[model samples]
Target: MSIKSALAKPFAKIIYKKVQKWANNPVDTQKKVFEELIAQGASTAFGQDHDFVSINNHSDFVKRVPVRDYEALKPYVERVVAGEPDVLWKGKPLYFAKTSGTTSGAKYIPLTKESMPNHVEAARNAILLYINETGNAKFVDGKMIFLQGSPELKEQNGIQLGRLSGIVAHYVPKYLQKNRMPSWETNCIDDWETKVDAVVEETLPENMTVISGIPSWVQMYFEKIQQKTGKAVGDVFKNFNLFIFGGVNYEPYRAKFENLIGRKVDSIELYPASEGFFAYQDKQNERGMLLLLNSGIFYEFIKADEFFTENPKRLTIKDVEVGVNYVMIISSNAGLWGYNLGDTIQFTSTKPYRVIVSGRIKHFISAFGEHVIGKEVEQAMQEATEGTDIRVSEFTVAPQITPEEGLPYHEWFIEFENEPQDFSALAKKLDNSLQKQNSYYYDLIVGKVLQPLKINSVKKGGFQAYMKSQGKLGGQNKIPRLSNDRKIVEGIPQ
Candidate 1:
């Protein structure tokens, strides 16, 4: 074996040991994480404001720190951004991860020195855990091509600001750096289309063993590689065996990827965001990701159905049940106290704690009280296209609420790479699949309260064009799948 592979084997063993310990006793791991975070930030302004010193357990902590969203935490974040020390965490943050916002223009999330390791470690351990579980460590001997955002971080009040992926790229492990691509110069390109071309030029001929990125961008890279080489991705990189993906659901794009690669390869899913790395797919036999209970974040869950109510029931890991969607609330070493992450997740297992991201709380459609979310829409789309030749490039759903439309109906704007023979049948199947998934939707259709779903076949590249128009074409930018209003649907071209 080469010197790098020889060194990595021992490190992999150590990480696997740690993963085994965490997996064996997740409840204890969670309690320890909660205590450590509270103790670490006990002297910060937020900690004092929330009575963090007096908090001894999960119940006490929850009672002291009320649930809050980004809007509620903006004041404290402003202080941190303005170079205030010990404002949120123990000291000033190393950088701020700037994420796209809805009502607000942008969200600047603090990334402290203490908390940065959690992000890096969680990601590293995810790969290590996979390696341990599958006995596939040879990939480390080759290069890893990570499709990330611009690495050119902007500074504000002495605090660096950039996309989370870009921020993390700066801290990639030294060992991996030797075999990582594309170059930092290529990654610093602000334009995604331009950046992808540069990345392809740099890494297309390298001995790439692993590829990691959002599905859409990676698909573009795969297409470019095929166009340049005139060969399948599998043929180009014979050793490429792993694809690590996050930022969006991979189900819709799985077939397209398989078609591009010409064969199936092992894959891993991660639940990382600007907020934190929450979970990773640890077991091939399991469906959901293993929740990172021991990470520097303490988690709470409020039932998604009750999140908008006057008083919602908040539950910890101890009380979270399988099969129920919950809005994730987190308190972390990064100084976010009871911050609502705005994402909904459903527990698939409780003993070792596994979860599946259901959807975004803000990205749901309930216009006629028949609530539907991203997961439901994605699943329905998958079901609708099953055994058919159709492939959805991108899609969004919106309520056509105006009476001038004759009947209230849900309109689906879909961009297809491979069009199905029967568009009407596809729409009917999607509607029927949704009805089966959501009882409220089923009741509405059965009572004739709502008309059948309408599918608007969007022109190719319409969604991409819409994203570009919004100035959010790549890297963590995704079209919200469901909306109560027509903002997203109206923006797309048929």
Candidate 2:
């Protein structure tokens, strides 16, 4: 191995060993790890705001900590960015990652020297575990193409830090430094006209291997390539390898990608949000993903219903039962101590720590008292349209409280692979599939909720057009596959 490889490989091995051992009880191991890290100034106890005196003691260490969301953290993050040793933690933040919020405007997440390691370790473990399983250490035969956000740093107080994209780019291994697509000074916030063409042109001549990014941007590039070259992306790229995507699911866009590229694309589910990296696709099916427990986080799971409450029942990884859906909470070294992200997850197994994301606790519309989740809707759509050209690209279901006929109705907007002969029959079949999957919806349809599922057809690239217009076309911004509001659902094209 070269000197660079020699240095990185041993450290990677040590981290991998710890991850392998912690997969069994990721929550407990993380709790202990975070406690030690807190004592080292890397983190803080969550209950320190109210029960600081008591939480500082040893006996109450493992008890649950009160959960908080990003809005509650605004003041503290502001102070950190302003170089003040704010509320709980002490340190001048080295950088702040900019992420969008539902209502708090935009969030400037502080990333100090003490906090950056968590992000790096999470990203590193993702690759290390992949290497251990596939035994493919040198997967990048040519340059590894990262379809990422603009590399330009937004400077605040003479310190350079803006987005996760800029921070990650700054920290890439020196050996692979030259392989980056967009140069550091390029204005990513500018229109796609300024950057996309050059990025495609530069990489075409090299030994391009793994292509990584959000599914939409990659699809955008694929489309752009087709327009420019007068040839499908498959013909242009002589040796296109693995297609690793994160941020969102590729199921809706997969067929078009494959049809044009003429290659089977292997995907890695990247469940990362502005908060942190959650889980990844299984490199080996049965083993699931070797979740990065030690990468700067202490984890906990709560019953989805327990979220948004002052007192919630939280479970450690050891207490996690198989085949049950739960909400995810974390205490990370990045200073989010005992934060509830509100995303829901399902445990596939416990021994090796395997899971599949079920839905979002906040992503439901029980306006008629029928509790419906994103996963149920997705599964129902998949089942209802089995073996039909009427595949849904994106969809949403929300309750309409005020109806002309005196009942609330569930509304849906569906994108298709091909036009259906009888869209009305397709709509009824979709309603049936939903009713079968969720008894709550079935009851609502019969008595309370509403009747006659309302359906609409969206034009191609309708979702993409909406996202681009919102200036949320890249980074953690994703086209929401499932939602629970008719107003939000109507925003997409028909």
Candidate 3:
């Protein structure tokens, strides 16, 4: 190893040791650490003064300050980019992590140097936990493709540099930096089409072994690479052993990925956000991803259905119940307190603090009065095609409103792996599967008052090409899996 890497190896080891200690600790002990962090964050105006004092010491203190969204911090971001110190906090922002808010198109989240350690620690914990579970320390060896966002900073505009992916990139251990696929310029989150092409050209020769990215982007890239070479991407990177997918579930593209690669890749699910790297797949293969409790964030869960209710019950690490869906709220070292991130999850076990991703809180279609969550849709899709020779390459469901009907109807666009022997039978089975699985959907199916579910098949590679056209390539970004409005879903052609 180079001297620099040799030096970093030990430093990385030290960090990993600290993370391993945290990961293997009891849930109660981790909870205590998070509680202390929340208390510290709430009591102090951290970025404002660049000082960590109790909230009581701050002058503009309200008894109970309400949670503020990205709009509340826009002025601070503008000032920070203008070279003003202490614009949001006391010191210059180390970087801005770009996030997509429900209301905001793109948001620049500020991060300071002090909080940078948390990002590193969270990632380290994820890697170390993988090693502990699989006994593989060479995970970083060979080529590891990170489906990343645009790394370029917005100089003169509203959104600035220092995206979450970029901020994390700035802090990656030096040893791993050399192995990151795609050039820094091409790894950007924006400008997806060009970046996708750039990554394909650069990484093709590295003899990559691990592919890590959002499922949709990866699927798109796989298709794009295949189209360019007239051969499958897996055929090119035949040595690829593991697929580390995060930001979204790979269930939709699971079989297709395996087929494209011509091998069963060891898959790892990572739960990370612009705010924090929260959970990772450590054991039980694909069962439940373990929460990184000690990595600078405290987590709270409320009943998924009760989220908007006035009196919703919250569950801490100590109080989590298995098998029930709960909405996730996070308090991070980055200064977000009691934040309802709007994602839902289910606890599979409290003993190991393992949980499964249920769905997004707001990503439901409630027009029919039957609340259909991401989990239910995912399960229904899996069941509808189970044991069938046909495979769904890509799919999306949207609630459409027709002038003839007051209520909305579901429109499904699915691409099958092969020409169905009986297309009508397949469609009928899909409708029945959905109705039987989801109550709200069942009502629509039985009533027949709404338009019947429509399924359309497009030519292969159509979805990937469409995604590239929209500039949403790579990392943490994908076509919306579920949307209340049909326009956005329909926008994803084929």
| lDDT by residue (tens digit), candidate 2, 174-263 | 667765555554436455545667677766666665678887677767777777778877677765656777765566567657765777
RMSD of 1: 1.6
Worst 10 residues of 2 by lDDT: 41-50
Predicted structure 3, TM vs. truth: 0.82
- Each candidate structure's TM-score, on Cα atoms with residue i matched to residue i, is 0.96, 0.86, 0.82
User: Using alpha carbons, what is the TM-score of model 2?
Assistant: 0.86
Pairs that clash in candidate 2: 142-207, 408-450
At residue 287, give the lDDT of candidate 1: 82
lDDT of each: 0.87, 0.66, 0.67
RMSD of each: 1.6, 3.6, 4.7
- Ranking 1 against 3 by lDDT, winner: 1
Candidate 3 Cα outliers beyond 4 Å, as residue runs: 1-27, 46-92, 137-139, 154-160, 188-190, 228-231, 284-286, 403-408, 417-419, 443-452, 458-475
Using TM-score as the yardstick, the better of models 2 and 3 is 2
Winning candidate number (TM-score)? 1
lDDT winner between 1 and 2, please give it. Answer: 1
Among all windows of 10 consecutive residues in model 1, the one with the lowest summed lDDT is 1-10
Please give the lDDT score at residue 266 for candidate 2: 55
